[model samples]
Target: MKTEYDVIVVGAGSAGCAVAYRVARESNLEVLLLEAGSADKNMMMHVPMGFAFLLKPHKNNWSYQTELEPYLNNRVIDLPRGKVLGGCSSINGMVYIRGQKEDFDRWAAEGNKGWAYADVLPYFMRSQHNEAGADAYQGTGGPLWVSEIVDEFPIHQAFIDAAVQAGHSFNAQVNGATQAGVSWFPRTIKKGKRYSSAQAFLGAGRALSNLTVLTHAQVTQVQIEQGVAVAVQAEVKGQSILFSARQEIVLSGGAINTPQLLELSGVGQQARLRALGIQVHKDLPGVGENLQDHWNSYIKQKTQGVKTYYSEGRGLALLRNIARYLLGKKGFLGDSAATIGVFYKALPQASSPDAQIHFAPAASEYDAQGNLRPIDAITISACQLRPSSRGSVHINSVAADAKPSIRLNYLATELDQQVAVAAFKKARKILLQPALQGMLQAELAPGADVQTGEQILEYIKSTGEPVHHLAGTCKMGSDAMAVVDECLRVRGIQRLRIADASIMPSLVSGNTHAACVMIAEKCADFILRSSLIELVSPTRPFGR
Candidate 1:
């Protein structure tokens, strides 16, 4: 293993993969990208329908769960984060969505310059090789491949048609000019296979020769020497090893792990670290604060007329699918879990679409121990897009591998509860549409008994699970609680930066992977700039 690199990117996740890719393509800097899990060579990971493969209690997943949410009648839910090369991108449903323009405009409005939708669109376009062809909104010869659904099932188109009937517009693309409509969700898949960020960046970046990727290497702490990140102590195959970075150590360990790493490295709240008997390097109280996630609940319906994923094609369906995948890469397995979507104002008084909706043709639910159980039905899950609730991630111990306390605190705010309740009402309306009514047999989940608003809220409290988009833990801003600056530099610490969903100042309007890719691409630009920021802190009086 190399002892030193020009840039050390800890966490070969959605952002870290992009960082290494951009850096290697732009500069000759020796970059080291590390991942805690093994390689992304698993065939199950490439199949779009195999999204739940790594999400299970597997080696490729972190398998973390949130504590009992006191506000939600005390329910602990599974939080599966990717540990492989592509990180969550590999395990996720492969939904390729850039949040609404207002999400970025809001960030720029909050003093994060160069983060407006207009400013960041080019980076998104630069990273995308959309199958829809190059246009003002998309690019052609980019790394990440974004395409429409491979096998567009009748249920998908039926759902979209049903949404249009329910007083919504039929949008060809949700990632286009507007985000408030029913549309066919774009996916990070190409040729019927899942194309994660690692496939787009690291897979292509290996040819650059300067970029090095190390799998199964878990970083424990960033060695802060005199308030400057000099190296990192990591565990590799039961051996603790230190790797030095000459320029910076970029933490892309997502929302939960990034903050945990910072605190483990003695760079969080002094009070917490002191109690854990660890020396404090920086007293950044917001290291794990401001945690947020989208609260989504499944509303399923038993359908009779529709042919769902559960139906087998007479005999040898599994064998035929495997053969088809190996030969032409076209089959049911190529289908994304969520091929249809809707964005609308759930609450009567809400402006724009405050809720995001997903339509799954196949009915599936997490069984005990968190395994996906397929059912012969259809499901429409809803999540309030911009929830006002906030939660936290913190550590009370120093063990690097020990799971930290994560509290999503779902529906902690009145607005969130109100919007969520309204969202379910809208979901019921769409399910009763004439198109879906033909296929629908009965309400399977939170069934006909759940009608009243109070009963719906109770049902939500009983069945709501996260869409698994956790973000904003180590927020970026100029506030006292800001863990990172506008440039993503860690507050009061030099030669360190965070480039992941964790650094988002606020939750984006939709799925976070696309936003995360854009963030990492921007981080590469900041690092490559000839003139860096010059900040003077207590320990670094000389310069930044």
Candidate 2:
């Protein structure tokens, strides 16, 4: 069997699949993609509403738990990342959104060359097959499909109407024209099935002879020789196997694992490695710093006779959902729990946007089991966009199998707390409006008498949680603090790159699946361009 290939793409998640698909189809490169979990052949992964099952520490998900957060009063947060072939894309909310143009422009402003909105627009354009057809802002022919929700629920329309009454304008396409107001979100779904990045790219390209995808292969380290990445060491079926990369080793292990993989390969801080008893190969200080994620706070209300998703008994609901989904892909299962979203500037004339609101029609609470607790309720989740605070992820032990320590530092920044308070207050006002007053029966959370700003703030701090948009551990920039350069090459390593959500300089305003896909599209071009350059340049290294 051939042990070496042109590129060894690790973590067959959203980004890794994109990298493999592009390399195999666009170039003569032989791409070997490895995943830590089994194929996304799970029946749940295909069902639009099967996310509930996939939300747990399933075969396709790594049920990661965060270090106790000080702001949440030492509560441990469950961080569920996909371990399957499509990674999180196979298990995410599936809402598609290109982040605000300002977010990308800020990357350029922060010294990340070629990452400005104008420069990266092509990559975003190239990734989508928007149902809205060709426009200056949206693409027509692309690998992934983006469609408008065909069945807009009543609650969704009510939320949009309320936002409009509160001075927010209606936007037909937030990913088009401008990302300045409220709109129905586009999703990475086509024909009512989740169009995971793996399905769009890797699955479609499986017919190609040059691409090979291995599942249940957990990569432990990148094999480096004389400061150059040459292969990867992984545990396959409880036995270690080494697969060589004739040309390059790409780390698409994401924010948490990408840095961990680099550190295990002796490519991180010397003192930390020494403490762990691992021989250090490279003393890179920025491998796992700069972790960032969005935090969510909810406003819940109950409606009498309005029919919440929480009313149905578990067995009956499951059976009905299954039967409906089986007979026709249309039903409650086809809906994103939070199908209606509004991105707005909480404070008019503010320097940057403060809040993002997601209106979920379901009357349920996500408990520790990732199951919806039975109850009659719909929730408005308000998130602080572009948090001013930042956190870090680092190794806790020298053991390669140990989980990395994650400190979210959520709500640590005053601006973040302020935004949370404001957004929660605003949601209350919207609920009280005449448009929604008749539909809402009563305030089910934080109650009506909790009027003071301080009271609302306290409520938010006690109940806030993560939206599952983690990024920036191996940030890309031109600073000494950056783990990778603009082209995504590791600072001190050759023929190695990290192309995943980990490389995002900052988190996007919406769900990150679409943004991660765009990152892969851009990195594919960068890799292809560099490979062509090496093919002709005199500096191309000869086989040793």
| Top candidate by TM-score | 1
What's the TM for model 2?
A: 0.94
lDDT of each: 0.86, 0.80
Residue 85, model 1: lDDT of 91
Against the hidden true structure, what lDDT does model 2 obtain?
Answer: 0.80
TM-score versus the correct structure, for each prediction: 0.95, 0.94
- Which residue segments of model 1 deviate by more than 4 Å? 312-319, 367-369, 530-544
lDDT of 2 by residue, 286-373 (tens): 7788888888888888875554455433578768866876788766677664677777776655665567888776655669867756
lDDT of 1: 0.86
> For candidate 1, which ten residues in a row score worst on lDDT?
535-544
* Deviation of model 2 at 441, angstroms: 0.9
Clashes of each: 0, 1
Measured over all alpha carbons after superposition, the RMSD of each candidate to the real structure, in angstroms, is: 4.5, 3.8
